[model samples]
Target: MDFNKKVIALLAVALLATGSWSCKKIIDEAPLDKLDITNAYRNVADADAAVIGIYGQFLGLQKTYILQNELRADLVDVTANADPYLKQLANHTTTKDNPYVDPRPYYQVVLNCNDALKNFKLMVDDRRMSVDDYNKHYSDIGALRSWIYLQLGIQYGSIPYITEPVEKVDDIKNLSAYPRISFEELLTRLIDFTEKLPYKEVYAYPAGNPLVVTIDGSSTNKLFICKPFVLGDLYLWNNNYTKAAENYEKIMDVENNNTNINISFNAYKVGYYLSSDYTDQSVRYLRAQDESTLLVDAGWRTIFSAPNTSNVWNIEFLWGIPYNANYKPGNPMIEVCSSLYGKYLIKPSQLAIDNWNAQRQYSGIPYDARGKLSYSTTVAGPVITKLTDNIVPATNFNRAGKWGIYRAALLHLRFSEAANRDGKGKLGWALLNTGIANTFYVGTYVNGAKSPVSFDEINTMQTPYAAPYYFDARSNNDYKSPWYRNTGIRSRAGITALDISLQNNVLGLEGKLIDEGALELAFEGNRWPDLLRIARRQNNPAFLAERVYQKLLKDGDPNASAAREKLMTPANWYLPFDWK
Candidate 1:
């Protein structure tokens, strides 16, 4: 089909619509009748509209993205009310005819991005847009396109790596003209493309700009994709461990001066401690002091349920797409996961519950707070509320929620993955289990003698390779340094630190990181990709196949054996690319 023709049709519909774009926070209040194909790149305003239009089209892919990424994984399962397509996804019986397998929506967004990139360059050449503005817009769109392509490669395995705008979808179908590249090749190309971009930072919009909108009193600056995050992932996937760790450090270290240990990006941490009470239940979990009194602690749940403006929420959510009920496409997750007022098509699997239940909290609690608050067992059934907590009986039909793309926890986990591979396994493990303060030590002088010290006293001396590699978690007497504020990931969840004796080697620690990812970010659509990436990295099909097989078998699926046998072959892990 002619993709540009569809773009024109959508643009016409958008011109007549009154609602604002849902995901990107770009409010297009200006008249679009004059912004036709001919003059879409004439000036800055027109260029901005074109970019917003691309995001507008991107809003439609949220449902497919989540389903494809989650259903095929081990964390989520199809409900009785789910359609055959969803069941097919969960069962690994997906056919080419499944609507979710159709790659048109993804390619549509790619076409729009390609068109925008081409026009932005022409506008620059014609002196219609300034160099700085061109760099910002170009880099943003480039990173976005690369991200979409990355998703496509992950889901579909091999894809036509088309960079230029094409007249028709068939153009990409011709393998001779545009050869399909493997995921590894695609990663190399994406890293090279993203690395060469002029802008490497998040897109900075002017104050009060609609793009920099306020959703629930929080600025949407984090919604825009960061170049470093994309590049970091690319490098990590490509097995360039050092480069991946360096790129991730760029986001973790906001001040860019690792030597200045005091000024660190503490918000990226999962913990929320400011005092000496390491086992303080008040900051970690809610407990009953007496029959009449119940203490409240919004520890891990706050990451999902709290408003974007809340410091507790904003600190962790690095990038999320906010959905409004008044927009064209409301939050699709409500219908997919909510059992109250929408079609509960999917639910959390028993394996996920078992995994969470097997853990012990730091306070010796039976369950992890994250799993307890992630999803609850309702009278109807088990519902996934991580993304649909905003929906209630009052406004059930008109639901509004957010689709989380990247968060600080995920970033930290990915960074640890890269670091462990790069021979920093001990540091990576410390960051994941306990804070650096507890894991490392230093010598302190008392009067005239020197003695070994840990935690607070260790703060006086910097960590080994304190520049870009080390992450300090010590809170000195003053408690003023940014590094002091960060506790480890498990510390934030009120969970006990992982036993280093059980997982001391790099391979064992890599497995721990993957498990930690599932525990921290199960339903946010990273499970399958994580499993697949690691399985591919280790060249162990059993790593991914066994988890999926167990999930199906535990759920009493009849096709579990068949799916396991099929997944034994790495090629069966991806969706079939037979879109005609």
Candidate 2:
């Protein structure tokens, strides 16, 4: 053979082999997907996979522009931006041309949920899954569907409860073949389906030490947050607050029974409070509420770092979801670090300092029954920039090279100082009720530094958060002079520990939180469709006003004259609504 010809021939052979190898790799990398229902619905594992398909609905449930995030469009302060999504929602009589304002995005959640349900229903048989678990999973899917529809109704005011999968293109040839369901009727069905569904119990216990049974009553509390009957069960949307409170109270009772989210009630403790006790750990009341729900594990992380927190029951929750995220949009403390004070170590906001001084009252001082502060801050300034100080910081997990924020603690989870006192003054101020202090110290790791920070320069921010320290003329009625502290740790440690605060707040972010649209659940993926359903945006003027005013007080109050002047108007809530 000619030398040139042999070279060309060898190259061709090598190319063919490489191409073949690539093809094999793609096939191997694909999910163990068996889309054909007819061929595979005969065994337990097959059933598991089929059910897994339904789980996809939940995949984006917490992700953006889907059900949860979409749902935030309705409430006052759920989304970061709410308008553009509203534009897409085609409210016929309204000027908006898009069907869902945030139309296409929400439908993705709905469509996927419908597809999962329809496909699973069609292929369901005795062969593909374990009969018992299969039914449970099936019901779980139904529960999820009911929630999706409920969100749809809330967003669009009407929706077609699509039951069957669009098996073929011909099914839509006649336009009238598929009709829309009214919001009222869909709402009823949501309740109907949710009624019979059993809670899908999935217990997640810490490794090795299995004796605790789930910290929230084992698997018994694994209930749905958005079941059909949830409307009647907890009441929702406009006029739902009262019943919602009752439902939350009911949940508290149940959780208490399981000893999952019990507040520390032991009478024998001395604190600044004459008779007070509370746990710092909190929960969101979503799914799988348990005793350990508030105990944020060093590993399990969530959207909130525990600062952007609130109660579905107004203020009954143990913790609220803060918007702090480590590598994403924004992290409360870490992001704050990038601010003038956090970045330059000019000192945390004066607001945060005030808040810290107020909270410190309970640690070493006292409070009276009439909601009066009975003591003062013995130690002020930079009360606690890190959560590790609140709990026994974990000492177990060490450096394999990865930076460790928290190790592990033998202490039960706690949120604010109140977590330890529980309505009786064990720590300091007597428990008038389960109250959380608004003040905390914000010290600096390095005094007045810029860009790179030293370990001792970390600081905190608090302005009007503190309780008045006496009749000092400098203090407002609800204000306290903020204190500062110099800490040995870095801001990273404080921020990382905050992540644990949110993830473990099953008590506040209880596993049973129902109807949490993406607004409050923004980015968390629980609200999109619901936001669309309500025709509201997460950061709508009204919403942002509330968030800035209440939910994100730490971020700053939107009601401030400066905030109003700078960011007033619902338009700020608008987004691109790019479901296209």
Candidate 3:
């Protein structure tokens, strides 16, 4: 490649990619002037840059991460225009030659975290940072490193989990002696690492302070992966339901319940109020420019738009990957899914579409609010709208938006599954109530009184009562129904729906919970893992094979029989990684 081409390639791979892990080679070859770990901690600004650089590594990983998680699942299928790379991933036939399959990028992120941890103490001892800040950095870097390892373990099964930085060629050679750690071991480490963090009850950036300052001087307050949320997710994966619930309770503000969260295009200026109940207080803190749009409800569609701005920080979202329009090669989802630029690279499977439309509450509308809001009707089929929008200008498009890591809705469903698995009937009931209906409509008035309804009250209302009470109640409070959020729909009075039934058997419950997860987290990148989790939980590969069978059948694939046979093999659960 020419110099210009090589620079462009590096920019595309290093800056544009978005996976959670990084390559060791990427770290080894990164220009010293750009990072310079030795002198990087000389001052507070230097330390800030070092930490921010680690986040940048995530920006590079976001695209790959979302694809690996979403495309490999049964819910979505690649478009006809999709490159061979994407098609291979969607078809579960990826080869070692596939450009996107490398784990080196993720290893790069781990190495970056190691370097930061290694040098941070020097800064603290030099009095450049307060002990509190030092502790925070330690926790932050530790949490980030563990998160990368968790992703690595999930994707690759086992990896050479390294904690030390590879400063020279010798370090790389020595790494060959390190043995790969099991996924269970990695999860245990994550649990321990997150528990030891400062354990702040709540995480909010200092008032008026930016969450992280970018290399170009832009700033944002998008939350990073915090302790309770990470720990809770790890616990859920570990099947420690009680422990998971305990960790989630610490940071999740259940009292302040609002499902429809609105974010501004101007992210740094937004201030989220931390509370326990959902009310006007949610909007009271939104920084308004002209006051006319002060409480202007951001469309449910806007949350996925570029410059995605979230007004309230409920326990729902654990962390978000921040994107800036000023930065080059913005969110990869937009590049692939946006109407203007996207050539429909990723398409929704017919089964996913059928599953979405099956819960129609009325004969008048063929699709639920989630179906309507999350997809666009094109001749090509239903294109994923959960992560793509056209509001941003074409020239300035692809910038601004965050990929959700772990949210309350997903966590709630996971807890519900875990509770059901362990026979914790009552706890499962409460978790189901809170988790599914955790939207903007939770704490609003009923009968003109400040009546906060339990999740069960809202979720279980019979048919003809309007999906979420009624359009009247929703319009009166400016609350969008849970249908748009994919939480669950309320059939009018006394009508039992497939999703509404609290099935008794474990398989029935797991199937329902799995469908709910697909509805709530379809394109946000958890579908494949959700499927694998359920299959593993039951110790049955048929659970997974059946889903794949459904997808292939829906696609009218002639090879469906053969594909199902191959997929039923136990070793097919997770793909083999290049490094391992």
RMSD of each: 6.5, 19.0, 9.6
Encode model 2's per-residue lDDT on 323-364: one tens digit a residue. 111112222222111121122111122222332233212112
TM-scores of the candidates in the order shown:
0.86, 0.39, 0.75
Q: In model 1, what is the error at residue 471, expressed in angstroms?
A: 2.5
Question: Model 1's lDDT to the true fold?
Answer: 0.72
> Relative to the unseen true structure, what is the C-alpha lDDT of residue 61 in candidate 1, on a scale of 0 to 100?
76
Tens-digit lDDT string for candidate 3 (317-358): 556664554455666777777555666788778878887676
Candidate 3 TM-score versus the reference:
0.75
Top TM-score prediction, candidate number: 1
Off by over 4 Å in 2: 1-36, 61-102, 115-131, 170-178, 198-234, 238-250, 255-580
Off by over 4 Å in 3: 1-36, 173-177, 200-219, 254-299, 306-316, 362-366, 394-398, 426-506
Candidate 1's residue-wise lDDT over 1-580, tens digit each?
2444344334423421312342122122212332224555778666666765666567567788889988999999998899988999999999989988888778767867887898899999999989987888898889989989999999999988878865443454453345789988899899889999889873335444445545434345565677788888888888888888888877776642435332233456545554322212112423422212222234455566555555656567667656655444477888788887689999999989888998887666677657766888898788988877654333655656666788888988998898888777767876787666556645565783334356546564335654457765545454444454556788777678887863358888899899988788889988988999999999999889999998999999999999999999999999988655
Q: Counting only residues 3 or more apart in sequence or on different chains, how many pairs clash (N, Cα, C under 3 Å) in candidate 1?
A: 0
Among all candidates shown, the one with the greatest lDDT: 1
Give the winner by lDDT: 1 or 3.
Answer: 1
- Residue 104 shift from truth in candidate 2, angstroms: 3.8
